[model samples]
Target: MNKIKLTITGCLGRMGQQLIKSAKNSKNFKLVSLTENRIVNKKIFGLKPQLNSISAFKNANVIIDFTIPKCTLEVLKIASKLKKKVVIGTTGFSKKEENLIKKYSKNIPILKAGNMSLGINLLMYLTEIASKSLGDNFLSKVFEIHHKHKKDHPSGTALMLGKGIATGKNKDFYNLMGKKYLNKKTFPYSKKINFNSIRKGEIVG
Candidate 1:
């Protein structure tokens, strides 16, 4: 069987490095290209990282993205033109940006998820069930902790959980979204789903 040609964006990011390591070990994929927002002088896995562009992703059959929202959109534009498949692991997209991604998907195949882990997906499923079981009497809130280097408050997983809550309640995720607290000792839960994010240490979850 032929190996799938793969390209990874945000080559300097935490998820980017992890993808490179995993892709190198896996037999099902051949690492073809690596891209970053800025120029990376040194070669990684014998391939120099390039800026996001058509040339950077032209040779790949699939592109895996774990970058910021702006960078992810940039990659989508290039991949759409190239007609390349994409797996989006990036998060923190605004409503407008999410709509934009939906528009791009009309042109090419796109699989997007905030958290790609099987465990998280299961948790999201359970969350929805629990929210529905609990009904509207119980208010919902989300809390998350990540490595100090991680950016974006509430984390994507938290948002996913919030979405599950919204889904259970049969309401829009954006409408039920509440306050986002960063590094707060304590927060309150309201009618809307509040979120508290703690960033510290080197926790990988």
Candidate 2:
């Protein structure tokens, strides 16, 4: 039996760098390719792995993307064509991009996540509890603290907190990050939910 081959996109980002490092350390995974915005040094993963030349995924069985939505869509298309399993960790997808993922999921085993943090996902569950029991009369507020360098401002964990609360209340439209907050107000918003973002130095979520 051969080890499973893996490819990573946005291999230059912080998380991408971490995944590559982990994969290099894992015995069951063989890194087949790396994708980046521009052609850079080839010594990624400290092994000089081959670069992924085909957007259609010619070199690996699985593809992981931690890039922007536009690049995600392109990678999704390529993964669909190659019929490779894809794990997407990119956050802040537009409505259209979300739908596109669903559209292609029928053909590929695509794992999509907002924050992809186990602790934060657990926190989402707790936020559900708060949303369910807390009432408008209680005047509850939700908050998030993240490193200033976080790619997704407000963090996907914060979005999940608001989502958990909405599910608890059994109603939507209760977010502090405006629907178009990223494009406009540049933050989450809720009259009561109050989604907040913290940007600071060396703070890890």
Q: What TM-scores do the predictions have?
A: 0.97, 0.81
Q: Scored by CA lDDT, what does every candidate get?
A: 0.93, 0.73
> Which residue pairs show collisions in model 2?
175-189, 175-190, 176-188, 176-189, 176-190, 177-188, 177-189
* Model 1, span 1-205: residue lDDT tens: 9999999999888899999999999999999999988878999989999999999999999999999999999999999999999999988999899999999999999999999889999999999999999999998789899999888887889999999999998889998999999999999989999999999999877
Top candidate, metric lDDT: 1
Question: Residue by residue across 1-205, what tens digits does model 2's lDDT show?
Answer: 7888888888888888899889989899988888876767667655443334564268688898988888888888878887889999888676567788999999999998777878878888987887678755444445566666676665666667767876777766333234322323345444546655666677876
Top candidate when judged by TM-score against the true structure: 1
Every model's Cα RMSD, please?
Answer: 0.9, 3.8
Error of 2 at 15 (Å): 0.7
